[model samples]
Target: MSARTFLRIAVSNTLVKNIARYVMMMLLALLLFGIILLATGKDPFQSYRDMFGATFGSAYGFSEVLVAMIPMLITALAVALPSRVGLINVGGEGQLYIGAAFATWGALTFKDQPAWVLLPLMALLGMIGGALWAFIPGYLKSIGLVNETITTLLMNSIAPKIVGFLIFGFWHSPMDTVKTENFVSAARLPTFFNTRVHLGFVIALVLLALFWIIMKYTRWGLEMRAIGGNPQAARRNGIPLKGYLIVIMCLGGAIAGLAGMSHVSGFYGVLILNFSMGLGFMGFLICWLAGGDPIGIFLMSFVVAIITTGGNFLQLTQGLPYAVINILLALALFVVLASPKFFEGKKA
Candidate 1:
């Protein structure tokens, strides 16, 4: 075959294989969740039915899922961006915290400013906060021979405490309510429906297109793919390995920062330590389940968002414990992680 034809075939084959693998992983996860429910003396099918009804059966319920989608989707983007450069940033939680902290401070600091200036400025601060958090570990990996995983994870532990400190020390609102004060209207994301869902959903969708273009069409994206796929080869080909690494880490951090900002400004409007609540981990899971395709990330995030919505319904409507939802998710990720090895048999 001609070179162009061969390239097309190769890309097509990769897409098909990834899709098949994703489907198998999802099926296995469902089976595992079912097994867990059985062991717990509950009806798996009934629980799943209840969950499904919450996400699809009612407008109010479905809308809540959309509201939840903003942060999870953004966090997934954060993790996926780092993975593009072959780094495991398990510190998404920390980056998220710092981002939210900066965003809250920015909005409050400039509450008197117009939305056009204040909003973008806060978002900028958030991205910068996230990048700064990621940059330290990226630097260590690039020059100091330190392990990125350990440094990143350590940061995660420190970030929440910082948030708590701010809450009790300086951020405690002057208002009667105990929580942080509501953010200025300038910082809030505009919503579409009367529901809590906001424009961050639009931002996530726009980002998918932007991600594809940046990764495939831009010089920077090519460098990231090169380093991620084969750093040694990239270096041999005269790519600036350190430059690419820094750029990739910064982009990843910035995206994650935006995630924290989205959660606070768009959803919570305050810097709550509970603002994280495992969202960083959820983002990591979404990236894995998406097979690193942006569109796939969007779709998988929506599904998980639905599952979360369903989990809430199970607790509220059916008197099921909320922990059951997490148990199901853990089961799902475990099954998925095991499937590639199980399906490694040679095709006939």
Candidate 2:
């Protein structure tokens, strides 16, 4: 085949594979919902229908779901980039928090600056802070002294404590609550409406476009994809493995940092204990489930977000346990895990 033909074929194959994977995921979700109904002795069809309808039935619910998806898009990008370069970035939570804390600091300290300067500065500093935060593990891995996962996870533990110290020791807002500090007006992001949605969603969308383009068209992306397919072969083919790893780690940190800014500047507008919470891990889950497909990231993030929103709705309206909704999602993940080869055989 000609090079153009090969490229077309590859793209065609990828589209088919992605579609098959999503179909299997949906089928698995149905099966699990049925199993849940059987186990709980509840009407599975009704429960499933209510759960799904709760996510999509109202404008408020739909908006809430999309708002929740914003962070995952950012974090998924962070995880997916490093993932493509064959590196695991477990430090996204830590990187995100630290970036938020520092961005909050910058926003407060530079209160006199205009938005044009302050916004870019905060984002840049956030990116730098997160990159440095993840760099330790990346450096250690590059030099052959330690595994990145352990080090990255350790950093995750360390991040909240550092934030705690800042809240208690310094940077504490005058509010009676000692647990979190509020950010100033210039520090917080402007919302799209009276709703909690922020410009960060747009930021994430732009990032999705950028990442997709990079992965699809760039030489660096080609190298990363080749390396991800098989590092040993990539190394043999003259890809600088360590350099790519460092790049991946740093970019991953920047992506996480962007997520951090979204929280501080958009959601909470404060430095709080474990503020980032499960978002980073959630992003990784999206990345894993989507296999670095940008469009898939966009769709699956919203789907997961809808489930989360619906879970909250169930809690508020039906007195359903939050744990039950989580269990449903977990079951879905398990189903996907149990059938890795389910999507591989699709030819179209």
Query: What is the per-residue lDDT of model 1 for residues 266-315, given as tens digits with 9 covering 90 to 100?
Result: 88877765668888878887777665667767777777787677788778
How does candidate 2 fare on TM-score? 0.86
Model 1: per-residue Cα lDDT at residue 342: 30
CA lDDT of 72 in candidate 2? 93
The local distance difference test score of each candidate is: 0.79, 0.79
Residue 90, model 2, lDDT: 81
Error of 1 at 158 (Å): 0.8
lDDT of 2 by residue, 1-348 (tens): 489987896689767886677767767786776787578666666666666777677666677887899999999888878877667888888899888877877887887887778888888888888888888888888777998888988998898788778777777777744545566667677787677788889899999999988878889889888888888899899999888787789879988987998878888877776677688888888777766677768877887887777778556655567867787677767776676553342110
Q: Alpha-carbon error at 115 in model 1, in Å?
A: 2.1
Residue 331 lDDT in candidate 1: 66
Candidate 1, TM-score vs. the true structure?
Answer: 0.87
Tell me the number of clashing residue pairs for each predicted model: 0, 1
CA-only RMSD, every prediction? 4.3, 4.0
Worst 10 residues of 1 by lDDT: 339-348
